[model samples]
Target: MFSRQIIPAVAAIGCVLCAALSGVAASAQTSETPYWASISVSKVYMRVGPSMNYPIEWVYQREGLPVKVLRVNEGWRYVEDPDGMRGWMAARMLARTRAAIVIGEGAAEIKGEGNASAPLRWRVEPGVVGELGECTDSWCEFSVGGHHGFIEAERLWGDGEP
Candidate 1:
């Protein structure tokens, strides 16, 4: 009787220990990783310093600009912009949305369709955001402000197989 009672008690304790260890391991997986995220919250505050009481430096005008998350600690993440500016911003101010850019020395033509020879619907100023879409070797489809079009692959950021 004593031996049988000891076996059941030990098994129950073993089960509790396993459960606790697994819970700790699962929480470790929930931590942050480096990736590009965006600004979803309206009026995301960029800090003059890292804490909440710090003065506002700039208000994010666009809702979705791609940002590289450098480090997350407590309530803030250090980030670097596409243009390579580094600053500390509140984690709540950022969101997981993707955005794109137009690169090169000349203007990007927004066509009515996804062909170079397609009719031009509008012209996007370099560094302006267009609705992102699929692509080929030399071009990626895009849209903006109710217009869908294609621009050269070299003229876009976050495009063509990223």
Candidate 2:
């Protein structure tokens, strides 16, 4: 009789534990972050702290440079650049534009489609910055310096597909 009573109690505890675990898993999934953005202006200062009184750590001159926004604090945002430099920047200096960095050696072919045989649109060199567009399968539409086409997703470093 004690075993029968204890089994139901144990099963109830297991169910509660499972529910708690699932809740934690859901919270973790929802917390995925460090969203992408780009510099809105031609020049901006990356500060050591979130306020203007803080010392400037770096000065960025590129208007379309991509940065990963780690978090927001009042009027400032903590960001990481393509070179992995982390600093606080004025939130107004960043924009929602999606951009990507060309990786690997040699130039990446900007094709007309996702296939290797697709018409060549442009040749983007490694480290080139480009605006990123829709991605499907293993390719994404990329435009850099007036050249627009599709590039293999593996060669890009921003938005979807790692």
Model 1, 1-162: lDDT tens digits are 999999999999999999999898665434566656666665676776679888877666766666677776666767776577777788777865555677677777877666778888778887786556777777787767777778887887665432
Estimate, for each residue in 43-158, the C-alpha lDDT of model 2 and write its tens digit. Answer: 99999999999999999998888888887776788889878899999988888799988888899999988889999877888889889999888999898878789999989887
lDDT of each: 0.71, 0.86
Enumerate residue pairs that collide in model 1.
Answer: none
lDDT for predicted candidate 2 compared with the true structure: 0.86
RMSD of each: 5.9, 10.2
Weakest ten-residue segment in model 1 by summed lDDT: 27-36
Best by TM-score: 2
To one decimal, what is the Cα RMSD in angstroms of model 2 from the true structure? 10.2
Off by over 4 Å in 1: 1-34, 48-50, 53-57, 112-115, 160-162
